[model samples]
Target: MRMAYLILAHDNRAQLDLLIERLLGPGGEDFAVIHADRASPLWPELRASLPEAAGRVHLVADPVAVRWGHSSLVEAIAKLVREAVRLGSEGAHLISGADWPVTPREAIAQTMREGLCHIEVRPGHMEERMQTFRLDTRWLRLDPARDRRAYAATWELRRLARWVDAARNRLGLPRSRPYGLWAYGSGWWSLPADVLAMLDKEMPRLLTSGRLRGTVCSDEHVVPTLVAHAFPERIAAHRRYVDFPAGASSPRMLTAADLPAIASSGAWFARKVDVTHEPDFLTLPDFHPAPMAHPASMRGKLPVSGQA
Candidate 1:
């Protein structure tokens, strides 16, 4: 079975090259790589580093200039997913520039053979809150100026927007969800081809909708939410390992000290790894070998918590 790897990358070209090599080295001919580089000027340099065998690796044209906690991240993912679907991928794995696959090729094949989709969907009322709130007002062209006067004006506009939303909520006005679908979970996911096709079909409408255009971090809510709406049973806690130390807003950059736990976690991948800081971690003897057991065996065990 073929799998499509959709990567949203902005930096760390060397690490990304190594990851592509490993994924295509053994038992990987059927695998395809679709990438979106956040409009970095160095993308051509990185693309040149990819091996010829990486013929299946395709970099997206017209990549968005992504900002953290903005809708542009979601737009990049949408572009990658659209390209992967167009390439006729049977399954798709969404990951970041800093992410590396921990599972060996054999284990990845086994997980696909079992027909499991790796995604985390936490159950709660937060989905409702996400749909109801309007925190992404920056897209309204209210912050055109970078000066203090502009900043003050933008702040006031945001305050007014929030107040309007609050009053609308109290009055029970017609607030719509993202493409009329409930939002859910961290945006990272490993989804089946069918679900990806569904996403491709719906993305245009969602992207054009005013609700998503003005929402903050819609990437965290869009994919898993739509996937859950389509097939709730396929939603399992995500298998990517991410360490969020207490009080930290983002996942800690993984280091050599994290190798043992990462290996034992039975996860297929881990994120936010910087090879420059810890060069030895990736070269460790046990880092790339296929686990003896199937990854599906560890399903439903890991917690579903992490920033996108």
Candidate 2:
């Protein structure tokens, strides 16, 4: 029943602190692991603030600078999973720095049995082919109001660097495969320990394959594609409320007014929650504890549809 509470965090110190506090109170000993980016010194400061996280902190060494449209972030996450497995984690609860878990811990434990149980979306048969959605070239290009091509171009630069590495390897030089893919969506995820180990083992192959580099957000496709290819029958496709995307780098910021909308979505976790709004969210009347049964263990994973 060992659950590794894993957070793929970057430079959001305030949000991370609030999230950690809500998830693990003083002296609470739910095994946790944090894969903090090298660019951000937030991990040190956070560890100083909460001494409990000191031993639990598994800081990334030789940290690769991650870009929104780059595959480095995905690689970092995979590395974290591998480290957790090495440390003897049975399963992992994948979450973002901005997310706050609303479901009761006891219930979460009941539902997850070394298998996937976090809120996520299942890609339709046709959607499965869409491995990458370049935010600049595809959907973003269609929306004139939102254009992030300039920012996305940064990832393209990284892709070029990876191509150079591939070229050098062709020339008989010692080289390593580049982990540079664009990925996004559904920040919260849970995976069985065995699946995680398999993913970790396959990292090198996924990185070297040029097919996934062009995608704007590869996070969405990486796990699903890997899991589908590795263990299709074991995969549980649930379009529950757990897969809502938070408005972090989006054009708009999520606010208190969105609570009613969130409740209606039947999602388990909400992202990018401001400190001021978290207490209010906990006290809302619609907030019901997860059902005693494990099947309904995720907080707010009711069956509804909107943003999720």
Candidate 3:
């Protein structure tokens, strides 16, 4: 399978470079498209040159400044999907800058060809995320921990938007949810070519129709909602491995202690890895990069590319 690895990176250049290098290891078949946040310092270096790996890698043009839990994250993924489709790959895998591969390349491809959209589904539709108005970005610097008072104006704007939404609801106006989409899932996942094409068609409309304008964590909601409603049959297990402990908003940073579970789990990749936590977790003798066994082709739009 010719696969497109769509990466959304903001910081951690060394880790990002290592992830790409390993991705292009011995098999050297798959290609990647990197979208560096415009506000990130790594943008200039990544755009100037990629790692010395022997695979096709491209930088996204005019990347949007991505803020956590904001609409820009959704916009960035949509842009990546459009670029991947243009490359004519059979499938696209959406990954974070902090993720690293745990399984061989072939296993990853096989998982993608299993005729299921691999997204980590959250229980229930989580209707409240959209019923209330949310600020696209709640703060300018986005570090309320440092100075919440600095964003007094932003808080006022959010308050005003909430009042407007409340008034509309009181007047019996419809909620601003787009396409009546209510499903939710994890941000990191993979999709077959047809779904990629479907997202390409629908994402622009969903993002710009003014429905998802105040959508919180649209990255986790918009695409998953579309898949749940439009292609419910294709929905299956998520391939990426990350643990979200009950009531935790973020995944725990993986350590060497988790290697056994990572290898045992059916997941092909693990996320939120940092070299500092486990200096030699993915070392040479323990883990090696090579070609994986290629499986039968993905169902539709399987244009061959150079993947590992």
lDDT of each: 0.67, 0.55, 0.75
Off by over 4 Å in 2: 26-29, 41-51, 117-187, 208-211, 237-254, 257-266, 276-278, 282-308
TM-scores of all predicted structures:
0.81, 0.64, 0.85
**Model 3 Cα shift for residue 301 (angstroms):** 38
Better of 2 and 3 by TM-score: 3
Residue 82 in model 2: lDDT: 74
lDDT of 3 by residue, 1-308 (tens): 88888999988776776677667655545788999999998888887878666648888998998887778888899999999999887888899888887777776787788768888665346766766676635453555776677666678878888888889888999575555557778878889999999999999888787776666776888888888877888888887779888898889888888888887887767888865335444451212344322222211212223311
Candidate 2 lDDT, tens digit per residue, 160-228? 756665675678863221332222235357677788788788765676675555555556656665666
Model 3: residues with Cα > 4 Å off, grouped in runs: 136-145, 151-155, 245-247, 284-308
lDDT of 1 by residue, 58-163 (tens): 7786778877666777778888888888888777888887887777755776677665668876544255444545544444344455565766766676687688
Local lDDT at 45 for model 3: 84
Model 1 clash pairs?
none
Global fold similarity of model 1 (TM-score): 0.81
Candidate 3 matches the true fold with a TM-score of 0.85
